[model samples]
Target: MSALGMQSSILVGGFQYWDSRRKGRQFPARGDLDPLIDIPRLVPHIILIDVRHDPLDFRFRLIGSAVRRNLARDYVGHWFSEFPNYSASSNIWPRHCAVAESGRPMLQRPTYVGPNKDFIYVENILLPLSVDNPGWSMQMMFLEFISKRH
Candidate 1:
């Protein structure tokens, strides 16, 4: 396997272990993921969403600086649809929605086209979060770039 593929596998494995340990409970809320508090062994890019709203209403509640540099622009309050054509936003949106609705973790290995048509491999994890809200419409997504060498 390629280096990116290997790294992606490791990340997926880690997420799987974490998921298994959760034992069907919902992921913690945004405040629970505070930088000063939550320290992940692998510093992946984290994103939170509120599925109660429109899919187009999804936002990035958290993102690491390293991940931010690879993205086209700031995505703090923007929907996934706001991403440029190079970003493969459309392909990933549906999967994200499914993960939110099912309240399950979804892992994806997608080739993202960055600025100037540069290609980068990204391993993303969409973990469902069940807040006190009625419909279990909250979710937290974590993205870890395998590497930028490719």
Candidate 2:
């Protein structure tokens, strides 16, 4: 929340929703996530990434409506490499891998967008979700754009 200032209620709210369902586990399982119940009003700000390690792939499981609207693109079922000249993906993908490796939630705030169609700021909250075994299979991302007004 540095340059972006305090965490927006949307982010806090998302965290609360995610944490409440944690039940003391390292991370919540993908099945535990119910979009309608977990983030009822922030669908556009949410994203789900399917993680793979055999060849290291990060594919989009879901893309929030808001993201599609703001980016003017729908990345569902696409990997970051599928899009070229997109700097944000380059910056974000590594952190995602880190979260998967650590099996912990990671935060990257005040993510400045550099003239990518429009100037914007976003905060990335990546929560690792595991289906079975000890490796993470899903990355529940709350990619929230902080209001530029503040």
Candidate 3:
């Protein structure tokens, strides 16, 4: 619900949709999310990540069209550590780790440093998805682009 403070309606709607799916649980189950029926408009900006333990790695489960276009590549089956042009020091890796460990939602505005330099910034929200698990196993990310570099 705190996502209301966000300037982007898409993010707000996405968060609200996620909140609605909780249904008294700490987090929603990944299977409960039906983007096509519920938040169709937000699908283009959505990304699904699978949280891997052991060494605490993250793998892309799904990537929306807008995200693929922005990155200029499709990373559906790639790990975060293998992101092109990004080293292990990338902030995204740690952020995903924190969300998985904390079982909490995170809203962030990160400077655009991806393959698409034309982007100025990105406003995104990461929501944890748990299914009868002690910790989150999956995460749903909704990103909203702010401005252009020009």
Q: Note the Cα lDDT for every prediction shown.
A: 0.58, 0.71, 0.81
Q: Which candidate tops TM-score? A: 3
Clashes of each: 0, 1, 0
> Where does the lowest 10-residue lDDT sum fall in candidate 2?
110-119
lDDT of 1 by residue, 1-150 (tens): 132243554455446544554555655453334433444644455555665443234556566665778777777766555665413356776776777667567767788756635456777766766556554355655566654564
Candidate 1: stretches off by over 4 Å: 1-35, 40-44, 54-56, 81-89, 116-119, 147-150
Off by over 4 Å in 3: 84-88, 115-117, 131-136
Superior candidate under lDDT, 2 versus 3: 3
TM-scores of the candidates are: 0.67, 0.80, 0.87
lDDT of 2 by residue, 84-105 (tens): 6332357666777798789877
Model 2: clashing residue pairs?
44-66
In candidate 1, the residue pairs with backbone N, CA or C atoms under 3 Å apart (3 or more residues apart, or in different chains) clash, namely none
* lDDT of residue 103 for candidate 1: 59
Candidate 3 lDDT by residue in tens digits, 69-142:
88757789988878744335876777887888888888888887667666788998999997555433889999
